[model samples]
Target: MTESLDDTALDRLFRTARTRNGWTDRPVAEALLRQVYDLAKMGPTSANVSPARFVFVASAAAKARLAPHLSNTNRPKALAAPVCAIVAFDLDFAQRIPELFPNNPGAQAWFADPKVAEVTAFRNGSLQGAYLMLAARALGLDCGPMSGFSQSGLDAEFFAGTSWRSNFLCSLGYGSDENLFPRNPRLAFEDACRVL
Candidate 1:
């Protein structure tokens, strides 16, 4: 019997989702990472271009390679986490747009221009990355998404010889409540939203 998600589950997964920094020594299994990716891929993208590419860094050597690229504030937490996902975008995403946007004629050409390619890749890739985080949370993992790293350094060390470019990095693991900051306030709907 399949049980429907209740409000408690929804609140835990969405309303209470926070950017966790501290982590326990527990490991994240490869199978769980695969499950997260599978769920995240179902999220929609513009033209279904699906520009995001993930490099899951789990091995000790891979983490070593990533260390020098991170800012001091992010390094310790990243090292303690069980895995780090290098979320990237392929510059040649247009090659797949024809298959993704079958009925839209000349859709692939929209990303042929360098500027257009950059915009599409970053925007869609970031959206996919967000889905990745939610999916991870649903799968009982905590995430620390950070952009305080050196993208160029990561590209040179990890993404060399590929069309993929580093967009951001996310540390994944079981979070420790000990280091968590108090939840901050959010703008009320009336203050932040505008009616059309």
Candidate 2:
């Protein structure tokens, strides 16, 4: 892990990785999904508060459960993919502090306040979501992460009676080049960063 990655690996992970809008007929296996989660869970979080939870909607029935909550533009993208992951955060994540941060006996109490828990969960969970995408890419998978979905509807359909709340949705599979638009411009480092 200490070695620098080759150009090919870097391009696959970031440089040339596009936000897929379409997928091929190829399927993503369950074992590969487990590998993605195993790699992603290694990403660090505040106080080791690993709040993210994922639901890999791989079956047609499961996708059907998720489709109605997606925006019209996103519905087809998700339905066509081999798998759609519901990236979520658990509001009650602090309860696992004893296990995740064994050295900090009071770690759980640190997030005792509802507001603190909510913020920490959301921030760290979002980081985990990004890590998931990169992990998938590292394993030669394509990603199409989208925010165009009904949060409340998704939560009700998938997370009701649970502490989990949807953060975003990402479809995964072999991407198709069909309908791919030209690469968009990105802000230069000088414009997006600071030297302070």
Candidate 3:
């Protein structure tokens, strides 16, 4: 088994990570975004459905298209971010089960129920979004994940005819520490966890 990560690495990935509201002028290269996804896609998922997909908006026109869907508070931050990622999931993700979980030919049947598929897509897709953030963070990029946006509007604007639906949005870049909202309190271990 691999050794556990050191505290510094842990801090960088979790403890010290903040939801940034502002970013630097430095551009985030498209290649870096590809690298981050390469890291994130390695993380596990149920049935290996791997439902998460992303659209990195760096172009002015794309960002402008996305702006109207964002809340007033998030609009400015989205505009300032070097790259804004639209994390989405395919509604028919289970169809890829045969390719992703090859050994189990019946894997697709397991999620055949529409309701079950819906839950799995949203749950696992959201997990993949978390993985995406960690990968970006590990690559020296700061992440600001926010949900203050119109999912319907975004879906219509970006995924109108596609099976993909927006799960969440994360802004990526070298963030300005000056832009942080004071770190909020988190539940203590005893309050948030349980050990049987």
Per-model tally of clashing residue pairs: 0, 0, 0
**Tens-place lDDT digits, model 3, residues 34-72:** 999999999899978899989999999999999999999
**What tens-digit string does per-residue lDDT give for candidate 2 at 1-196?**
7999999999999899998998999999999999999999999999889999999999989988998999999999989999999999999999999998999958899998999999999999999999999999999999999999999999999999999999999999999997677899999999999998
Q: What is the lDDT of candidate 3?
A: 0.93
lDDT of 1 by residue, 115-160 (tens): 9998999999999999999899998998999999998999999988
Per-model TM-score on C-alpha atoms? 0.93, 0.97, 0.97
Q: Sorted on TM-score, highest at the top, how do the candidates line up?
A: 2, 3, 1
Local error of candidate 1 at 69, Å? Answer: 0.5
Better of 1 and 2 by TM-score: 2
Instruction: Order the numbered candidates by lDDT, best leading.
Output: 2, 3, 1
lDDT of each: 0.91, 0.95, 0.93
Off by over 4 Å in 3: none
Residue 166's C-alpha lDDT in candidate 1? 92
lDDT of 1 at 38: 99
